[model samples]
Target chain A: MKVRVTVMLKDGVLDPQGKAIGHALQTLGFDGVHDVRVGKVIELDLHGAGEEETHKKAEDMARNLLANLVIEDYSIEVVS
Target chain B: MKVRVTVMLKDGVLDPQGKAIGHALQTLGFDGVHDVRVGKVIELDLHGAGEEETHKKAEDMARNLLANLVIEDYSIEVVS
Candidate 1:
């Protein structure tokens, strides 16, 4: 099975990287862009695990290590 | 309009970050995890642009700045 975890900055959080990216886009002539929020994705391939178990494990990973709960949120999906 | 860009490392590319994450998971007792691939996601909010234009601009960003063509693949989706 394969699971994908997406971790993103929470609402109202200050994202310097995202601000920098937005500014860079404007500098590069992409003036239509309003805001940019940068996040991360993690893909996990597991063997001998059912969909439920895989999702559980992935969610655990996200909550424990992949995300900062105070500022970031994450979602998990089973892809295969 | 809102656009989401997902950037991932291409297969066969070495990902030290992924390896480190996998190792950390095992050390933390999530031993069922096999392989992990780390990627990135960028969310862009655009004002006064149609869906087609937003996607086009996002694709341009991915190609020129957000992703490295040599080792990464990116997909752009218009979410709103």
Candidate 2:
């Protein structure tokens, strides 16, 4: 199974990298852009018995290794 | 409109960050994981006339600023 984990800064947390990207975009004349948030996407290829087990393991991985519980939020999806 | 841009390293490119994450996961006892790849997801809030224009603008942003053409590829999506 393949799982995708998306880790993003939680709402209300400051994101300097996102701000920098937004500023650069505006400087480059992307006037329509109002806000920007940057995040990470981790794609995992797992060899597991079933989709349920894979999804559970992916979630555990996200909680334990992929995301910081304090400032980051993570979402996991089992991909085909 | 809101747009999402996912930028990832080219297939043949080496990703040390990804390798480190994979190794860390394995060390932490995620035995099911076989392979891993890391990428970026950028979310943008755009004020535009229509979906098509917003999508086009996002593509332009991805090409011009978000992705390194030589080693990275980007995909744009008009997110609700």
Chain A TM-scores in order = 0.94, 0.95
Residues B2-66 of candidate 2 have per-residue lDDT tens digits of: 88899999998998988998899999988867889999999999986489988889889998999
For each candidate in turn, the TM-score is: 0.96, 0.96
Task: Report candidate 1's interface RMSD in Å.
Answer: 0.9
* Runs with alpha carbons beyond 4 Å of true place in candidate 1: none
Error of 2 at A80 (Å): 1.3
Judge the docking of candidate 2 as incorrect, acceptable, medium or high: high
Interface RMSD of 2: 0.8
For candidate 2, lDDT tens digit of each residue in A1-80? 88889999999999899999999999998897788999999989999548898889988999999999899999988896
Model 1, A1-80: lDDT tens digits are 99999999999999899998899888888887888999999999987889999998888889999999999999998999
Best by DockQ: 2
Error of 1 at B62 (Å): 0.8
| Model 1, span B10-73: residue lDDT tens | 9999999999999999999887678999999999999988999889989998898899999999
